[model samples]
Target: MARTRPRPRPVATGCLMGRLRGNPWAILCVLSLAYFMAQLDISVLTVAVPDITRDLHTSFDRVAWALGSYVLALAVTLITAGRLGDLYGRRRVFRAGVVLFTLSSLVAGLTTTVDQLIAARALQGLGAALLIPQTMALLVEAFPVARRGTALGVRGTVGAAAAVVGPLVSGLLVTVLDWRWVFFVNVPVGTALLLATVLVPDDDRAPGPARLDVVGTLLVSVSLFCFAFAVSQGERYGWRGWFWGLVALSAVAFAVFLRQQRRRQSGDPLVPFELFRDRDYALMNVVSVCVSLAFMGLVLVLSVFFQSVLAFSALKAGLAIVPAALCSMVFGTVAGRLSDRLPAKYLLLAGTGLTVAGMLWTAAGMHEGADWPRFVAPLSVIGVGNAFLFTPLAAVGLRGLRPELAGAASGVLVTTLQIGSMIGTALSGALLGGGAGSGPTAASSRSAMVLFAVVAALAAPACAASSRTPRAGGTGDRAPDEDAGRAAAGRSPCREPRPSGPGRGQGGVPR
Candidate 1:
């Protein structure tokens, strides 16, 4: 007797959740909230550092691990987590992550020692890594190609808002309630996310049995940890020889990992090389790093400038930057919509140019006596620029990728951005005269901003290169892989193909 396949559950029937289930917009809302919660944790703990140190009787340096460990774990595990989503279902992996993150937040809230808090934070980071990649991959699968940009744009807006709002929220929580509430806040959010998981489509996984690249995972994880450790701790540790040694170890391990991937590309590699074959995808990776580094470095410097130099409270400083974040939220969605109609490269160029201008303007205007109000314009310009760049960046980067590879591609893209942010933090700290705790002088802040402007400017050429190939707007254009397959079949991939039938087009959709 032949085995019968089990029927998949119907998601869009029965009760209220069932009615909303499998709806692309509903999934987008759920995914966006998950991303927001994860991104919020990245910066929220900083404002609670003082209270945490006081309550736990720990030194500032030790308390710093609460932030560092979270970031480190997130960065290192992202690649593996992405691949896992490909093997397992994205919704399954995402729900598991939400569960871990929620439980970890509870543990973190109840922790009596700083060490326990650090452990909980690391777990939270791991949880974030698992869910974040799935958010992108699932978005790709849930929405059609035409509507994907709008969805991603909305998600980007939420993530940007979360990052900016975290400080203010932390301050409010710590002030009125306690520092413990910082972690406790995530409990309700996480629970909501888990409950909403049922709304997500259950078919968001690659169809295959694939092996996890254990060796590659270990190698890349070690490399990322070493590199992150060196970058984040170099200034704190006085740039010691051991720090440089770790950097070298990271480099060597990465080289080995690349070799392993090359050998295993025919099998189940953690990162599929085919994703990089498209010029836009490869160039976008560079663009991702540059944009991340520029934005994060400037934020670090300006945050310190607002608080330490200008004597603004953490909440006030967060409020000062609210204009930019608000602009990012508005313009990012617009840019995403525009990307579906226009080439994303032009927006990237305009965005980077504006960011460079805004950084310089803010830098020049930043004086010791200047209040936070003085930065509203320049910061707003930077925010608008960020909205444009980040919103369309993902759309263009993943445009030509195969659906099966979306999870891995999302992982690689996010990892570059994370590493870039870490680097920016290290660079900003060095330029700010050691760390944010030290009162950064006006001159140092200006110099740091200038450095960020220069970094932002570097993205222009990469952006230009990323879009030389025509986009898949109509029957005339095809995805890179399809074009490659056509070329291999001895046909001109660039030549427009005749419509398949009446009211049907090249991609097999009815007009």
Candidate 2:
């Protein structure tokens, strides 16, 4: 006697709408608040470097470590944290991260010694690494395909806004109160977010029976940490034996990680090799890394130039970035909406061109006594370009991932972003220090800006290459796997898979 299959439940639009309508933005708000706290810690602390150095009797290098440690930790653990979320549950990991981060923030604020603060900041980074990927996974799971662009647009806008607002908020607090307030501020916000997260429903998606690649995780962590450390300390150590030794170790670790990944191709790899089979996804990853590097480097140099070279107050320097931030928010939202209607390639190309143009403008216009308007327009233009670039790249990167690997892909993407930022900060800082003696006045800053402009110019070719690929799910046909599932559920059999490679069945569906 054959058993009858379970009946497929009808998808009720009213029920779906009802479930979503009850504070749908709650999750986004929680994630955004956490993100804002992290950004604030990084940016705000930079402005308080002098005060920290004076109070703690620390050198510039030690103070720099306070920021670098957090960045390095975040980059190293990002992919690992994402895998953890996939193995357990994103909601659980996210809540854990929030609790850890809030506690770490409190510890950081109370720390008396520099070493204690550095350790606290590193802990905060660990929390951020766990929190970030889950946010992306949650967003994808919470929103329907039709509304995803809007949701992501809001996410991008909030991140950009935080980048702008963090410095200003930090400046005000540092000037009026003390540097400890920067970390202390996260406590209340984090507490509120933690409470709100309990209301957001969990995604009930089934998890795959994949083992965590512990060896791969260790190798990747060592490689990234060594690389970040070498870059961060390169100027002090120079190209001496110790520096080269670290670089060599990093190279060896990278080689080992690649070999391990290749060995586990048939099994569940830490980072699935199959994910890179799609040329568009591969190129987008490259673009994402490069774009982040350029943006972070430019911002670092510009902030320093405005403060140290131009003698602007911390508050004034923070406010200087506001025009660009506001413009980026507006354009990002508009571009996200347009991406739903237009090809992502066009938006990327246009954004890349604008970015290049803005960088060129900065390189040309920056001078000791440059008018505010000249800098403002270029900054705003760059922000607009970034707005266009970020959302579409995000939309494109995860466009055709399988549901099972969505969390992993999101982790990879966010990891690249943080890694790129770390590299950018290190490289840009090196350029500033290296070029310090080349001239008097703000010449070093100008030279560093030129380096950033060169990087921005390179993005155009990458964007052009990306624009040539066809959009995901453009074949207008469902895959064989989806068809089989539909038939099993008693729905009419869907169309056959697109005539592509073996992995094509899982490649077209947006995770």
Candidate 3:
């Protein structure tokens, strides 16, 4: 009898190359559109707040719920959604999120009352939370590691551009048509994107046997909710009693969550402790949180300053951010490309330095009578610095993660970002005190600038930490080796070991 010939398996390189040649740009477009819609929704409504308030017959403070509620919901559920995507399938969750977001946009557009709009916005946030983590996970699964930096750069650029365009577009719509149009516009665009997403092939990788950690999720959600609420409402409620009480409670909840997570003997933890075992991943989280805090705080302060202090209209204020946004988009791509070739730590450090310098300059020069051009120069510098930080920091955080942990890591990364934004906005708002002041306008500007400078300064240590982090697959990368050795020795890598099964992918896609 003759021996049978064995069938050859397709090479990963050939498979990936074939996919790229066939429909590479399609996925990028879909992902970019999703990201753009999510970011645009967040910033676009800012300029329309006054109009929304007028139409809803609500006060400015009540109108803030239009933004705050969405953010609060997003911050609370972001991690849970990410983990859920990892557990089930990213594509499924992402598609569902897009549909939900589209429906919510319609609800918001048709809303007649303040309560209706707020509920719609909260729904929108929930959809966004589901959408964001899965988007990154899809990108990671679709793109090779060598190209991830570029992909992430494109994502960052689109997001930043959307932020810049949001107000300008919203101002035009509100001025010419109605504030509701801002939400209405998303309907057509989102519908098209949803149809397009359906054509994108799903990566139905096998999932691990790890079950969801319901208690951990609840604890973390409560903790983050309390923390975000405390930060956001601290000024209104008074920092001494209710604010501090919530803060303390949040801390305790966090502690309890950590303890419970550590105590788990089986099932998937809401956040795998092993993910943070990597120094780079841990440091990246810190850096991401700090950078987000600084960026959000600066944007909030500058938006108000540009309109109130510099006497710019809403459209002009939106346009003023254009240069910075453009600079960030340009620099972000450059930095991302450089990240593939150069040491990420140095790039991150340089970016942080530039950001710090820009913040300091802004702080020093922000006088009531300062020229707009002078302010633009510093703000543009800050944008450049942010661009520098965006891709490298992301690459650093996710550099060496295996395919299975991708979703969780991305979830944690985004969660940190949301937390940072909440904290930054809260801190800045608390200091600004509802943007009202009978004191010298310069004094108010100075106080905001100082707050920004302090946040920027915090990035320096994160930069240093990045420098010390070990790269994946490098000799110095001890965490992976340790985990591997533990697995080899029949010990579980997680704090609480469950029955062995497949691991999560590096991009947060199940495998």
The most accurate candidate by TM-score is 1
- lDDT (tens digit, per residue) of candidate 3 on 252-302: 999999999888734578887878877788988888788888877877777
> How do all models score by TM-score?
0.90, 0.86, 0.85
TM-score of 2: 0.86
Better-scoring candidate (TM-score), 2 or 3 = 2
lDDT of each: 0.84, 0.73, 0.75
Q: In candidate 3, what residue range of length 10 has the lowest lDDT sum?
A: 1-10
Query: Deviation in angstroms for 426 in model 1?
Result: 0.5
Worst 10 residues of 2 by lDDT: 495-504
lDDT of 1 by residue, 340-376 (tens): 7877788889999998999999998988799877899
Q: State residue 111's C-alpha deviation in candidate 1, in Å.
A: 0.6
The lDDT of model 1 is 0.84
